[model samples]
Target: MTTLLRNCRPMGGTAADLLIEGEVITAIGAGLPAPEGATLLDGQGMLALPAFVEGHTHLDKSRWGMGWWVNEVGPRLIDRIDTERATRRGGFDPATQSARLAREFLARGTTRIRSFADVDTEIGTAHSDALVALREALRGTMDIQVVAFPQSGLLVRPGTLELLDQALRNGADIVGGLDPSGIDRDPKGHLDAVFGLSEKHGKPLDIHLHEPGELGAFALELTIERTLALGMQGQVVLSHAFCLGDVARAPALYAALAEAGIAVATTAPPSRAVPSVRAMRAAGGRIFAGNDGIRDTWTPYNMPDMLQRAMLVGLKNEFRRDDEIAWALATVTDWAAEGCGFAAYGLAVGARADLVLVEAETVAEAVVATPPRRLVLSHGRVVARDGVLAS
Candidate 1:
């Protein structure tokens, strides 16, 4: 199938007609004639940008369709885990839940999502199964990457590592781990097991590092050490390394992270200072952003729109200038694509036809306003439009 996206402004450039044949973009030029039988998606001079690549999300714990819950207590990280297990042990279907969120995300111009599926002894491969099922179900609409995450500490739980292995065998794409020193209390042992699984399965790795201050920095150091030792340069990602921003040695840590080739993800948490995008990029680090939970057992707030998340990231990071805001937007788009393992993502000839047509005229305005996505195309097919499924 061929689709012609006409009169679309290329970010800050003039209007162009983008022709997509099947999945890859074939040509992009102004006033190009549309071929016969080709579908015409008139953008009407809307700003066109690459669709968002969600580098972090948890579908297993998503509370989109289920009733809402406001955690009234301390609601610490551990508390959320307990709440999730207690509230989600039974009567939870990941396929249906993830499918709904996929639609919502696509409508908001997110075409690819790397989601964490908790893999512990208690839940076993149940979560992985849900995500695997959803991945298959939403193959064309949304590219789903399921990470076999041991939400529970790997060494703390005796049989958890095996469960992680099972999750990977069961179809999870990336091998995931939690805070090494903070949660497991043994950074070496935790990372050894985590890296062992990735090596054994020949899969990439991403770990959640919500550890505070020096602890978080230590965890990242250990992770970087293992990543370098294993030579898994670009294949490893550290999500929520908020500790890098909290500690005084933040600049040094950022430089180290860049040298070690370890990517970091930030959700722009409300508590502390996060990594400086400029510094990280300057030191050769990739920074991506994703909404961790969507009205899940962990937090009350949830949004599938990566654009809105980009805005949050920009605002929380104190990005006020145009270039800074543009870079902030890339945190969910181009900058994120590399971290999420997307090889062909963007609005150019030979790139994957994953683009969004927004109502704003420029990229900065689009990030600020995030007016509803006019049209979202995934694999050269219309997936969503105007914040809903495209007809």
Candidate 2:
């Protein structure tokens, strides 16, 4: 497929024409003539951005409002999550909800996502199966990585180990765990199980951490040790270490993780400075943002806008110039995209033509305004045009 995108600016930079051949971008500049029989898109005054990437999402719980509505006013968000987890059933009709959310994300210019599906003995890998189907269904349209996540607990959930192994055997890319220490006082041991499974199968691991004190920091330390000790390359991710703030000596931990090449998926907001991010980034660590949970049975925060997550991180952090904020937001898109192995997710030549054109002339304005993805392209094909939401 050959296509011409004329008069487009990327991240509010110089105007250029984007020419895409097949899946890779062939050229980017103005005055580039379109090939014969090529599709032409008028990018007049639009800014092109790499497609938004959600480093973390829980697709298995994408839709759950019926039982959720009844349990309103839960004292804490996590509390609400527990309630939803307890009472929810049959909400995720994978065939319908997965396709629905895929289109929703495509329309929003998010072509890359790393979603988690809860795994356990009783569930029998049903979530993974559904997500696998969704992955194949959206193959040419979107990049979806399904993580075999143990939402309850690895040891706590009976047969979780067997089920996790089954999930990997069935084709899960990442091994996942939640509350390493909280699941069992022996945080290191629990992590060992998850990491051991990862090492045994040569898969990357992403863990969920809710404990904010020493245990949280300790869990991260153990992960770094395990990642290096096992010689696992690009095989570890720590999600939502929100309680890292409670640890008095987190800077050194952050620095070590950076040196060890450990990546973190943070849910950053202005109020939460996330000191760990500053120290980690300074130490050359990769930081990616994840939506974590959408309006599902699992979390009160159901808004699945990666742009909003970026905006929150920007507003919460103090930066010397606008570029810092732009870079931070782009991390969720560019850096996270790379982590998900989407090499062609940028505006450069040889990259995929999956790009979003926004209304703002400046990156700061674009992020703050969180405008509709003015133009969305996938595989050099225009999946969405003119910022019109798909019905």
Candidate 3:
């Protein structure tokens, strides 16, 4: 299929016509003659950008445990585990639930998602299964990356590591771990076992750490140490290393992480971590953002808007210039992907023809307002297009 996207501004440049053939972008420039047999898409006054990539999420607990709570509690990830378990076991179907969520994300312009599925046996492993099914079902509409995450301590939750192994065997792309310090208090040993298993299975890893305190930092350090020692070939993503910001170890830690070839995934609005991110980026560290939760038992807030999250990230980080904020918002889905060693998916020629058209003049305006994605295309195919087609 050939498609021509015309009159759209991208990366703060003059509007151009993007020519896509099959799944690859064949050309990108202004006023090129329409290729033979190409569908033309008018893009007047629209901001065209690479499709949103959600690098961190937990579909197992999304939109659950809403209300019926006394007070807003502390660190809701743990509470989410219990609530999610009951819901799944109480005859809530996975296929139906995941399909609904996938549609919601697509409707919001999110075409790529890297979601964590809990592997702890206590949680019954239903989430992992649902995610696997969701990935296959939404293959054409969305690119989904499923990580087999041990939400609880791998050591503490006997057979949990084995469950992770099972999930990988069943088609999980990444191995995951969470809160090494909170889990076993033996960060080194736990990471050893977890990464060891991941390495043995030849799977990449994504560790979730909230950075509780000095203890959490210690845990993250051990994780970095083991990943380097293993000489892993794939990316090692550390999500929410907020402690690097809180524990006053931004400079040194960021240097260490960059040197070791690790990327930090700060999904939430890091009100306390912008200086840390700036310093880290200066010191060669990479930072990417994602919408971590959406109406999940994990958070009272249910809206999963990565664009809005980027605006928050920019506002909290003090990017005075609108273009600077635009750059920040584009980081998570583009430059960050390159920094972390993934294939490019942008508007340039030879890139995947995956893009979104929004109702805004500039990327900054789009981030703040988050106007509905007017058109969404994946692999040069029209996965979604809002509004009626002209006669």
Candidate 4:
């Protein structure tokens, strides 16, 4: 089916009409004539942008559709992990809960997602199984990349390394690792296992690195070394590498990360130290944004809106200029798409027709205000309208 999106500003630019023919944009120009028997949808001169990309998140852990989950976990990472494991042990359906969160993300205009599914000795690859099924179910509407995440340390928890391998062999798309030094107390062992799995399965790596300061810097160096040595350059991503916020180590690490082709994913947490998006981009490094946890067992404070996530990123970076704010917008759109390996993405001719129309005059205003998504399209079909998902 051919659909004509009329009078929409591409990237907050001049008004134009987008002609989509079966999942790909065919033409983009002013006053483009609609084809015979084409469905015409008025854009109302709204800003047209690519659908949001959620580069890092925990889908299996979200309690999105459940009751208000009072977060009573302790301050440390282990506390949260223990709580999550206990909750998982108690048996809440992952596929159901994750589907709820994923649909919420879709309604908010996210068409691509890279979600971490926990893989441990206790639950084994149960989470991975559920997410792989979910990925197949949402094949046409959304692109989901499942990471076989070792939330519980690889070395600390015996047999988890084997389970991660099992997850990769079964269906997980990527190999994920946690704090090598902080959690496992064995950075070398942790990295070796994850990188080895990536090489064996020929998959990518998205490791969660929450270790701060010098400890995190050390882990970053180790990760870079492995990425280069294994020739896994662009295939590796470090999520929440808080060490990048350290001015003392950021410059060198940013340069090294750029050289190694490793991307960084930041949730832009206000309280914690975050990487300078401008500095990283200027240093030739690719940095993207994500909404880490949405009303999960860990924290109750997050939404599924990538636009709001972009606003938080802009605020965290103290971005005031329109261009600077647009850069923040890219963190959740273009940059995030590339980091998550979503090809043929964006508002351009010959790209996929995964677009979001927002009620805004400019891209910067869209990021700052995050007005309701007027309409959302996936595979050139209307998937949502007015913040509600299409049936």
Per-model TM-score on C-alpha atoms: 0.97, 0.93, 0.91, 0.99
Top lDDT hit: 4
User: How big is the positional error of residue 206 in model 3, measured in Å on the Cα after superposition?
Assistant: 0.7
| Model 2 Cα lDDT, one tens digit per residue, 10-109 | 7788888888898879888778998999888888878788888989888776673333443364676457546656655534464566666767777878
Worst 10 residues of 3 by lDDT: 64-73
Model 2, residue 75: displacement in angstroms? Answer: 4.6
Alpha carbon lDDT of each predicted model? 0.86, 0.76, 0.72, 0.93
* Model 4 regions more than 4 Å off: none
Q: How far in Å is the alpha carbon of 29 misplaced in model 3?
A: 1.2
lDDT of 4: 0.93
Stretches of model 1 off by over 4 angstroms after superposition: none
Best candidate (score: TM-score): 4
Q: Which stretches of candidate 2 lie over 4 Å from their true place?
A: 64-70, 73-82, 90-92, 269-276, 386-391
2 versus 4: better TM-score goes to = 4
lDDT of 1 by residue, 1-391 (tens): 9988889998869989999999989999998999999999898988899989898998777879677666764547777677777777666776778778877888888989999988788778888889999889877767889998888778998999888888888889999989888788898899899899999999999999988898888888888888888999888999988887889888888888888878888898776777777778888888999999887778878698898988998898788898899988989998898888887888789999999888887888988997888888889998886777874
Ranking by TM-score: 4, 1, 2, 3
Q: Write the residue-wise lDDT of candidate 3 on 189-299 in tens digits.
A: 678877877877888888888756677678767777876788862368888887776777657777878877787887656434533457667888777777776665455
